[model samples]
Target: MKQLFSPRADRLLRGFGIIGAAALVLAATVGFALSRSDGTWGVGTPAAQPIPFSHAIHAGQIGLDCRYCHAGVEQAADAGMPTAETCLGCHSQVWNVSAQFAPLQTALALGRPVTWSSVHRLPEHVRFQHAAHIGAGVTCAQCHGPVETMARTVKTETQSMGWCLDCHREATPQSASLVAASHAQFGVEVPPLANCSTCHR
Candidate 1:
C-alpha cells in the first residue's frame, strides 16, 4: 500500500533461488565424483602384509595359480586367505633361515593365523561370492587386476557398486553362463543386475 516493496524484489528473489539451486547441484555433482574417484577408495595403493610376499614371484614369474593359496575361491563366498602353513610349505625349504620368514614361523609355532592386510574389500553389506564369478570364468585378474605383475598386492579396480553393476549389465555370453551356474550351484534364480538383492543381502 505504501510502495514498501521494490518492483525488482521478486526478480532478485527468483534469481537468488536459481543460483542457489545451481550451486547445490554443482556441489552434489563434485561430491559424487570425488567419492567415486580412486583416491577416495585407495585404489592402486598397495597394502603391506606382515611378510613381504611377492605375488610377482609367485603368480607371475613362478606361475602359481591363485587357487593355490586362495583355496576356497571356487566353493565359497570368500577367497580364503593363505595360511601360515601354506607359506611355510615352500618357504620352509626355500628361505627357512631368512629373517623374513620369521612371522610365518611364529604363526605356525603359535598355531595362530597371520593377519594379512586386505587390499580389496567390499563393504560389509555387499556379499560377493568368488565361486560364482569363478564358475562364470571370471579370472582373478579381471577383478584383482594383474596381481602377477604386482610385487605387493593393491586394489586396482574400484569394486564399487556402480562398477560392479556396470560389469553385470555388460556381461555377454558369460551372463547366461553365470545364471546357469548360479542355478546349478546355489539353486537360486539369478536376479536382474539392477536388483537391490543381487549384491546386497
Candidate 2:
C-alpha cells in the first residue's frame, strides 16, 4: 500500500497545476486585450433632423448657449428640446422661408412639436441626469462632441458606464474651476461622484 502511493503522484499533480495556471494566464491576457475595444458602442450615426438646423450657425457664429435650445440640460433629468416657440423666436425672421427650414414651418403651422431625435440615447435601464453632468461641469462637447462645429450632429463619446466611472475616479480639486464655471453658468452644484445610484435605477 505504501509503495502504491508514490512520488510520481506528486509529480503528476504538480504538472496539472502548472497547466491550469498557464490556461488562466492565457485567458486573462486575451480577455484584457478584448476589453480595450469599443465593443457594442454605437456607430455614432448622425440622426436625421426633421429640419436641417446648423448648430455651427446658432452656437458658433451666433453664440447661442446650449441651454438656449436644451433648456433643461442643466436643471433636469431630461434635456428638453427647444419648444416650437423657442425656434420660431429667431427663425421667424432669420431663415423664415428657407427650403431647408420647411419642416420647421410645417410644425409651426400644424401647432405640433418638432420631432427631433436624440443624438446620444441612453438605455432605459440607465437613468442619466443631464443636470448632474452639466452641474459637474461636463461640457456638451465632452459627451456630445463638438456639436457647435457639427453641421449634422453625431455621437462622440461612448457614454458607457466604465467611461463615466473613469471620469468620477479622475475628479479632483484641480478641476474645481470647471465645476464652479458650470455652477455659475447653470446655477446648480456640479459635484463629482461615482456612486452606483448616480446612473442606475
Candidate 3:
C-alpha cells in the first residue's frame, strides 16, 4: 500500500518552525541588549555636577553626615541644598584663609546661594523623594555610588525606571517563611515597591 502526504501539512510545519526560530532569536537579542546597557538600561548616563565637589574629603575624611550638606534628607521630600551658611560653617575658618575660597566667599558675602549643578537629576516629569528613600533604609551609596570614595564625584548609576523596579521587586516579601531570605537579599525593611506615584509624581 502507498501513503500520500498533504502539501498543506508540509507548509504548515515549515511555517511553525520558522516562527519558533524567529521568536527565540528575538528573545535572545533582547536579553543580550539588556545586559550590555551598563546599569542605565539604554536610557542615558547621569548628569555631571558643577564645582567638582569631593565627597571623599567631606564624607570620608571629615566624617560629615550626608545630612550636613543635604539637610532636608530627613525632614522634607527633597533634600535641601547646602545654604551659604552651611558652606560658611567651614569656609569661614578654613577656606577663608585660602585664595581658593575667594569665589565661595564672594558668593556668601553677597548672600546668594551657590549655584552647584545637580548631578543626579531625573527628567522634569519624574520626582524623587529623598526623605522617603532615606526613611526606607536606602543608603546614600546605593544610588550615589560610593560617594565617600569619589574625589571629584562622577555619575555612577543610570537611575532608570528598570533599575529602580529591579531593586524594589527583589526586596518585596512573598511569604512569612521567606521573610529572612528576602531581608537577607534585600534589607530588613523594603522601601515601597516602585509604584508609578513613587517616582512619577
Pick by TM-score: which candidate is best? 1
The window of 10 residues in a row where model 1 has the poorest summed lDDT is 177-186
Compose the digit string of candidate 1's lDDT tens values, residues 1-201.
586658799688889999999999999999999988999989988787788888999989989988899999999999888988888777768656688878887888898888889978778999788887898788988888888998888888888888888788666434564354343214544445545656777
lDDT of 2 by residue, 1-201 (tens): 556646999789889999999999999998876765545465357777887778888998899998888888878998888767887787777656577767777777898888898767888888777786777677877778788887777777777788878887577533454344332214544444554544565
**Clashing residue pairs found in predicted model 3:** none
TM-score of each: 0.76, 0.65, 0.63
Off by over 4 Å in 2: 1-40, 94-96, 172-192
Residue 66 of model 2 has an lDDT of 85
Per-candidate alpha-carbon RMSD to the true structure:
5.1, 8.2, 8.2
Better of 1 and 3 by TM-score: 1
Q: Alpha carbon lDDT of residue 132, candidate 1? A: 78
The true-versus-predicted C-alpha distance at residue 196 of model 3, in Å, is 2.5
Clashing pairs in 2: 135-190
Each model's lDDT comes to 0.80, 0.73, 0.69
